[model samples]
Target: MNNISVIMIAHNKKEIIKSQIEQLSSIHNISMDSITIVDNHSSDNLCDFLVSQSRLNYIICDDKIENYSLILNTCISEFVNTQNDILILDPDSFLLPETLKKLSCALNPDNGIYAVCPQNILDISNDIHSFSAALNYVNNNDVSKINLFKIIKPEINTILLSHKLLSEHTLFDSEIISDELCLTDFCINNILNDQFTYMADNVYQYYIGNHNSYYSPTNRNCDLAYIRQKWHMNYINTIPSSNLISMINEPIDKELNVLEIGCDCGATLLAIQALYPNSTLYGIEINPISAEIASHIASVKTANIEESVDLWNDIKFDYILFGDVLEHLRNPSKVIHNCRHILKKKGKIISSIPNLMHFTVLHELINGSFHYTDTGLLDKTHIHFFTYNEIIRMYEENDFNVINTIASNVTPMLSKKDSEFIDALTKLSSHKNDMLFKAFQYITLAEIKDT
Candidate 1:
């Protein structure tokens, strides 16, 4: 009857298991009652060590259970009678002393499931077991440590599931042979069902293994593609019925001729068409596939889809939109300069750039590693990183006057104390020099300069 139950599924990670188990056992507030380990058919004597320690309950898989889903489901099924909060941990995952405490503090009955470390480095070498193994490799000297006591979106590894919620949602997708989408699909499905809110924050330190190919860049890329597909499939259906128009600050006006750069799938364009039916909308995109999809969406919406044109061209436009596009460009300034030229006097340019300097990223950066992933500032396709001031300067230098700037309030991924620690470090770094220049993203509305 401990507050948490830690479950780990390991294959042949003999070298790291002892240390990982030792670290978990040492957590200040957690008890032995909160832990369980499932060793899938391993060649090493992992079972003997677990039995020797007598510290954790271990389940060994025989030839009867061959797949990961069966192993995971079997383990969870056994824990069903425990009636304790369950945490799924990878064998290579190393927990900081305060990790569980912070994660527990962030857990809420309202949020269906929670994860301490939402995203970490995947060790592709672990793919032989059909599970994606990840490591939290932060350059501690360079990156700041994160506090995990904050209620936030669940991260990639390390999930916390309530016993009751587990009963309601059933177990992980045992059918998905690859662990790639099992957890995510389950969580997203539950979230959509309003069964539980998926909360994640950076709470665990992962020591990635290179023994398998689960984390190889290629596999990671494939996982990302799958994630995006899942995300789109699960969430895209809600778009047409969603109240997205309210998210836009100013509605697209019928009198204005608009240019939307990076019009992916026409979600933004279609939304604009709904708002201002008479407005002429133009889109520029680099991905032909996405462009085709967007064109199709536009056609369905009965909105005009113009031929793809480079922004550097001299075509005049009444309004230009960099909508979630600036961060992807190598030289955002060049695009801004070109936009300045095309915009008529008093024209507006509205843009949305993902904030790379968000507190989560700041926390990750302070920890010392910058790894690209499926999402966030490190998105593989992004070429430029800008802070709030840099964004303003980029526009101002190109003869555009900033009319309005809105900074979205985001929840911190770390606990208040850890966030404060990061904030202190950020301030110290800023005072020593200017650090606001590293803001995550900037949303700007600028006016073209008069000749």
Candidate 2:
């Protein structure tokens, strides 16, 4: 049995809320016993209509109340202690009956699973056979039967949280006024805590629609400021992506040791050494000229990462940097493993790679153009390409606990307004998160998992 309680912040849109509640009621064994709807001062009769639903408990927040995180916290706190999982939803995102069933299947307490997300097959709900179709889908759980899903990350649209997180009221940030910004911050915090979140993306389809129509633009800048102040994280821009930067962004105890593979011309080492001037800088580069230049700032060695397992016999670094270097190696996984071996007990590795699913690459593939240029997503130097899912799997396989994942340059650089590809994406339903194809690069930070 699934101990699921549904909670959604419904501001308005009488039609959308009405449909969502009806759909939730029809799910097989799921009932409205612990379900709740927060009517955020709806101008329409939605408040009255929601109250009319005797099955669902409803709350009407006054127009003066603005912080959504506080509202969700209050509602979750009222739940009975027996309810150990809360499914947060957006009225625009409709889930099939099997959505929770699959989530429950993956929510094994032994595995440290704390959250779940469903695979959304783009807005194909109108094409969904029946509620029973979902039932059959989950029962079989065949990989071949599943449609392609965009990697679903944690978003408020449809997510299941452990009751421990909700009842303690730590999942959502009360200080954050922007809902999107708040969820992002929440995800970042959870990741840093070694909390595991699952994406049961292949199990069922979640119809996507206007999940953020209520987002307030006025609060965006403030929320961003809060994130920056709290994390002390500068956005990863033109600099080579490095997890060392995140570790060095704030003050540290003593001078540390840092290493970079493929230290190309040593620009990265110079930049980072400038920030943490006291730390010793080291580099391993294959090109003699680049290695020579890198020696000015870092203790540069002319060597191949794949062949140099003994490159650092006596030294264990506090941090290792791999900025767009792994994808070029014959066995990126093996290179990562060797790097991990040379790290101090708590050392970390930061990496960045061009996203294979970026819209420009997808669009070009759709148009039958499969050519590679000098740089960018299809850089000829790239021997291995990865999507977000593959990147996560790679780190986990190497016995590393991914502390954080940062997606940079998403959507803005690549979207086309009048292209056939844009229409293709529009037809598919996402869980109101950024389209899977929108990201340009994924900059990742991971540390060696403790034995």
Candidate 3:
């Protein structure tokens, strides 16, 4: 891959963004033009600074879509379609002079490997200074005697993604929605278990305590809940994605029309491609970058009702999907009402919405720490929140009869620290299964009612 693109998503990191950009531009392995900054509507001087740096490709989200996974996925959607190799890094992380060269040397592009991870990650937030200075210290005569590339444990600091993962349409899930956790999931679940990983002997130092993070502490903790819910009870691989596959009771053995809303990179559609090879697929996404990528898989229209409704016209559909999308809308009920006009006689509305009454939310409420976040169920962009009953009621009100309802990403499935937290809660409650079933998202399959 001749083209190398570096995507750094940051908001309000005024001090760190510039330094990170400088460190990146200094990389001899990649050109400065390849560096792209994703500014999430930062109030900091990041936007103005980015404007001055004409060589950098910076996408300023005027819409203020704050979902972390959505932001990352948007960048991936833009570049993954090309032959360019992608490097995703934390904005405050400093790369050594030999960092990119070592990583590039370790990667085997022809083997369908998606990423090569860093071997030694020196988290020098306590003493992190200039990249050149850190490199100088590492290269010091006395320090050079020590092995700098001996770490065996994998990390989420920096990941170099190959075109193979993009060709497969794999990206960070907008639903899971945490930067560190998402990278960890992509590395552990998608890459490490397979032969798709290349562990490079390079070091990266993260600079912290320098500027404000885009996310608040509460937001970070809330996102951690999702990571917890995913691995809950060690049920990792089964972490529900679109829930379309689980909720679709009827078969699509015949020629049918299927539509997916908020289909970031058309991931779910890509997964079940073999099942509905004959079916005509359509996608409605809010992010333009993701919409472009989804276009390759299906007929795509950018959404929020106003844009896509005109594009969809009066055409009816067999299935209209909403995978973790309803919450982000200003008026979810109205959107559902409008979607009714395009539903075929037997068409089904399939959706996976985060549960506002999740066990973690309940715990947060009890602890008095619930807050909106850049990601997770309480995503800042989410105007409408739903519980299990609310979702069922929404369908019933929209001329649809719920046929199948399944709980996904349940608290009992998480294998991490929160799983223990869930266990403690479950033990105290008399309603054990009921408490355990307060899933992260509720998946529903509703059939259209006769008018």
Candidate 4:
């Protein structure tokens, strides 16, 4: 039988650490001796509090070390001296009592399960959706054969690593300051080398927060802008030029005219140009800074996309793309109506909106917090939310027919198995008896009717 050691690392998470510990304590079946916490120079009195707890063995590291992988490896090593099975946890991750036990039972010492992650319930926040979006993009259809290493690079939270696996791979590299991609890089390399098999099942809940290593407020507002631009540019350069040939559902042979509403930095427009050599793309942006960036990127790529929202009235388009933009608008319906007017007969509008009804959002609302962020369904800039029905209604109301709808990030709620419990909780939180489930958002396509 494998003995389990839960290793948790923390920095400035003092405010939530005590509650996390308490929650861990309340876990019914786990032995009290199995948990360990490492505080890596938290400026607060988190260390003192942990030391006083009789149930936990705590370690305090010097303040100078800030990289999470180093702190994580140290905690695992210090607690599980022998090659015991270990579960690494982020401070914000919460687990049910039976979670660890289930994981332990599933581990095969022969094939050696590299790591197992619980079905994550992400806390809604800015850039949280980007990760969610990426997850949705990968898991959209049949994910059984999806290349895990190619799709998801490792990062922090909800990973269980075997001691043998750790020893063979060596401790996480301390030199990588950027926590965002380091762990994922390690996981990919190791998985490719067949060091261990990565097995993720449904077990834990992740409280999405602004403090995650990559999406900090400073990075979201600035660094991410550059990163997204590069990602977009790379995406553009990779596709074949012939892929740009215009193919609206319509059979029209007229030169294709494309409109990209809310074209942030024109990366997608540039991509469209490369894909459809004969097409003319137009970009419409609301933010001047982003618009200027788009124009600059266009110039740099030598992509020809007529840019201007001022020309909205005179221009016509065979295809218009919303590209993760509609949900941010105060009135997405109004925007759709406007797009309908400018679209030629049978022209299609393609969009990718976050599914506001995603299971993660439903999980959060039931738990009693609906904090909004600068991105995703709750982005500070977003004034509207949509469901499949709502989006269909909006298009139908605008004299457009709903042609196709693809539900992404459609993972079921971690707590959904307990529908009765969820219903009971919903009743308790009801004002006038509405379930009030918050969806993550959805993407849809609609076509304007011919006269």
Estimate the Cα RMSD of every predicted model relative to the unseen true structure.
Answer: 14.9, 15.7, 15.6, 15.0
Ranked candidates, highest lDDT first:
2, 3, 4, 1
In model 1, the runs with Cα more than 4 Å from the true position are 28-33, 51-55, 62-66, 80-82, 111-155, 194-206, 210-451
In order, the Cα lDDT scores of the candidates are: 0.57, 0.68, 0.66, 0.57
Candidate 3 residue-wise lDDT, 185-257, digit = tens: 5654453234344454334444443434456677667766776665442112212254676665446577777
Name model 4 segments beyond 4 Å from true.
25-33, 53-55, 121-156, 195-202, 206-211, 214-451
The TM-scores of all predictions, comma-separated, are 0.46, 0.51, 0.46, 0.43
Q: For all candidates, what are the clash counts?
A: 33, 5, 8, 16
lDDT (Cα, tens digit) per residue for candidate 1, span 1-451: 2577777777776667776766666644555645677666667877677777655677876443244556678777675345666777767656544556655665665653333343342332333232222222332322234433222123334666666677566677555443435554565455444443333334444445442423246544554566556454312211221222333444445455667776654556655655666666677665554455455434212221233234434556666666666776667787677665567778878877777666567667878977887566788777888777678888889988888765643443547775566567667764532234234455677888777
- The most accurate candidate by TM-score is 2
lDDT assessment of candidate 2: 0.68
> What clash pairs does model 3 have?
231-413, 231-414, 231-415, 232-413, 232-414, 232-415, 233-413, 233-414
Error in Å for residue 445 of model 2: 21
Looking at model 3, how many pairs of residues clash? 8
Query: Candidates 2 and 3: which is better by TM-score?
Result: 2
TM-score of 3: 0.46
